[model samples]
Target: MLDLWFSEFHAPDAKLSILVKEQLYSEQTPFQKIDFFDSETFGKFFTLDGLIMITEKDEFIYHEMISNVPMAVNPDIKKVLIIGGGDGGTAREVCRFKTVEQVDMVEIDERVVRLCQKYFPQTACALDNDPRINLIFGDGLKFVQDAPEGAYDLILVDSTDPLGPGEGLFTTEFYRNCYRALNDKGILINQHESPYYKEYAYEMRRAHKKLASVFSIATVYQFYMPTYSSGHWLFGFASKGLDPVKDADFKRWSEFGLQNRYYNPGVHLGAFALPNYVQEELQKED
Candidate 1:
């Protein structure tokens, strides 16, 4: 019997490891290193540059939280822009609403999308079959910067951490471009990193700060993702004027009669109620 393991370093002193049944695939793309593994506990999962991107068992939590939050806020979102969600989970979640007419998914690396389509079909199901989804392999920052004014009703930034290719998406200029690319009431939901680790916490606050500086309403909501650092993760919600908790049209959202594995009306509101410490963290600078 042999022992094979995979590890992601959260910090100098902390890490998460999963025992591997097999390494399904490994490749170094122009952007990052991508790997797929199978484990008994987590089922199947993948990583980029040795960082866990998503796992089969817990991916629904993140994809639904990011897509459904903004949808519940404005269920009538007809046109959408997704930045960096190469897995297609976010697109799959968003396209569930028949109201969405066009979905432009801009992923920098086509390899991520292609591999996920091969290995993670459950999440990638909508990537090809959906008529509304248009796959564009390009830089997210430039995509938004060049977007027509008031072009999209929702812009979802399901990106990697604030480094390498993903670093540009966190900039003040990028956020401002997203705002400019959106309709008057459009919403921006981004991958706000975790709050548990000192490194990720800095990213969380920095992202929120830049968002606040650009949008009329910028706030973060929490969800628990077991595979991610600390099992606690966040998604940044920003809009021209909509408050996620206050403006969420639960009544309208319920009309869809969608059954979700993770998100619901109550969970929607509760996600916005940040813990005291996280609230303090977001408010610390000002």
Candidate 2:
């Protein structure tokens, strides 16, 4: 008998490991290394370039928090553009909204989408069924840059940490393009790095500052993702005229009657109340 583990570093000083049942698959795509494993506790999970992307157990938290918060603030959102999120969890959550007429998902690697659809149907199920969705296999940065001005009502950047292919998605120029692609009332939600560790915290602050410079209102929200680095992750929320806290139409969102495991009207408001330390960190001069 042998013990097998799939592990990832939360920080240089810390790491998280899961008991592995089997190595389901492994591949090196042109963009990055990809692996899928079956874990005793977390169920089936996958990683990109050795970083955890999604797991069967807690995928709802990341997907729900990213999609629901913006939709709750503006129930009439029709066109949405998702950059990254090849796993399709983000798309699944966004498709739940009947008001959304179009969803354009851009992923750098088409292999991720194909693999997830084959191995993790739960997340990839809606990738094809939704007629509103237009799946684009290309670079996200270029999609936004080429997009017509005011082409979308919402843009959800479900990107990975700033590294490798995801690095360009975090740049100030990328944020600027996102602003131009969005309508006046459009909202932008991005995967803000965690604030728990020094390395991740630096990226968090940098991303907040970049978004703040591009959008009229910019803020960050927290959620618990057990598999991600610290079990504490964040999403950046930016908009031209909408304040996620002050302008969120809770009553209107509730009318949609969408059932969710982690997100609700109450949680939507509470997620924006950042801790004092996090606020202080984001306010630091560059």
Candidate 3:
């Protein structure tokens, strides 16, 4: 939760003004505000740390980068699963790749999906029309656990922060379930916490370790967002055997020509190059 703080100060010129703002994370208080955009479900979008995190804007960035990078790497990806993308932006992006034969979107909240479709049309417009896509309103954790082994080629966990309803998703059990739900060469992608901010690094590290236990290769990638606490954020990529850096065949990425604002063949290749500190931290068994 974001905390709000207020105080009054006096200057040498004898002028006094009241200061008010929000505190992001645990330490960073008095966050400044820019433009507040409209949201059908959440009321308004609050800008902080140079990231644009409106219900609509997050749909574009999160869905675009999450779905496209893996799809670009695995060009022949046929079966896909999206967990917790109630807005449906990830589903919309998954449909763009013609190689994808089927996509199953599992969202815990039926109301969020319905509200976004009704009010945030731009974010959820493509959900209802796509014949290749199936929207299933259910708990992502249970759904993945009960799913048959080697079912999905690509699985994306597009969930909220681990505070309320999303707590179970950040656990080690969830990662284990995801590993079991994937095919032999199946790939799993999840939204990790911010690298620039240390608030959730401990939890993220645990999640990373759990994924590493099951997958041959596990790596973290970063992207810049304007409305989040920090400008940069991380995502986890895990595969049974696919080496994200070396296994990515560049020829396929050139063929797709998926126009993206943030992700490209070069960006996809570079994102896996974690800094020295991050690499060491992720490897540690905290």
Candidate 4:
């Protein structure tokens, strides 16, 4: 009887829309506005501050790329710190590794975690069941600042865009603290914004420059997230000693026998091969 649609603007001049079957839930958390919806094509999905965060259809791509690439580089990674991955998809992927001894997830908004557990159990299922996971509700920036030096082997910044609650997580100081919080062989993975749009590309370059200055090895890898602004997105891989490509042990990673929908040993190497335009943009003097 009625047609419903959910829409997001990729750019001021461009927008993407999904046919909504129903609006399942809505809430205004202290940190941001959150909404969950059921769509005809994407199935169930959620948004924060009107921006799409996760859709049931293609979430595996984002979660897999962020977690597995770093793990492949260093299978021995034991301690992990995840900053702002409230939906728990990133945590689920990280917890799959038997070698990871501990996982500390710092989500600024508790509501995001609770709501995802209620509405998107597929992603949030591992939040409580995993004995290795320590869920903390607070500022992610401060969490890293207060953490003892060399506390974590891997730090994954699964933050929203460089705005609102997630703004501080993108700062140079935050990344500097992440560098200090990690061990000598630790790795840092961040949701480096998309490169197809001007606004996102600016933030991408800014994040890259800051990380490059803080870590001995800083590089970006690409992935496709259909719900995100442009189906194209990136993750920054930074570390004091490990180079994701040069040090990635494909043979050892394959031995783990992990079944993934999007990530694998070969895809691990291919994701780092950025397009010529993107490479040139990162190389530009800022």
Q: Clashes in model 3: which pairs?
A: 50-226, 51-225, 51-226, 51-227, 52-226, 52-227
lDDT of 3 at 270: 71
Tens-digit lDDT track for model 3 on 1-286? 2233221111223222212232222222232222334434334343223223344445466667788778766878899999987767788888878788999889876766665576556667778889998899888999999999989999999876665566788787888888898988899999887654455566668778777877788888877654444545678999988877777877886687777776777888777877787777677665
- Each candidate structure's count of clashing pairs: 0, 0, 6, 0
Tens-place lDDT per residue, model 4, 189-236, is 999998898888888999999999998899999987888878889999
After the best TM-score superposition of candidate 2, give how far the Cα of residue 175 lies from its true spot, in angstroms.
0.5
TM-score-best of 3 and 4 = 4
Each prediction's RMSD over C-alphas, in Å, is: 1.0, 0.8, 8.2, 0.9
* lDDT by residue for model 1 (1-286), tens: 4499999998889999999999999999999999999999999999998999999998999998998889999988999999999999999999898888999999999999999999999999999899999999999888899999999999999999988889999999999999999999899999999888888898899999999999999999999888899988999999999889888999999888888999999999989998999988887663
Q: Give the lowest summed-lDDT range of ten residues in model 2.
A: 1-10
Q: Which 10 residues in a row give candidate 1 its minimum summed lDDT?
A: 277-286
| RMSD in Å for model 4 | 0.9
- Model 3 ranges with Cα > 4 A deviation: 1-58
Candidate 1 wrongly placed segments (more than 4 Å):
none
lDDT (CA) per prediction: 0.92, 0.93, 0.70, 0.92
Model 1, global lDDT = 0.92
lDDT value for model 3: 0.70
State the lDDT at 52 in candidate 3.
Answer: 37
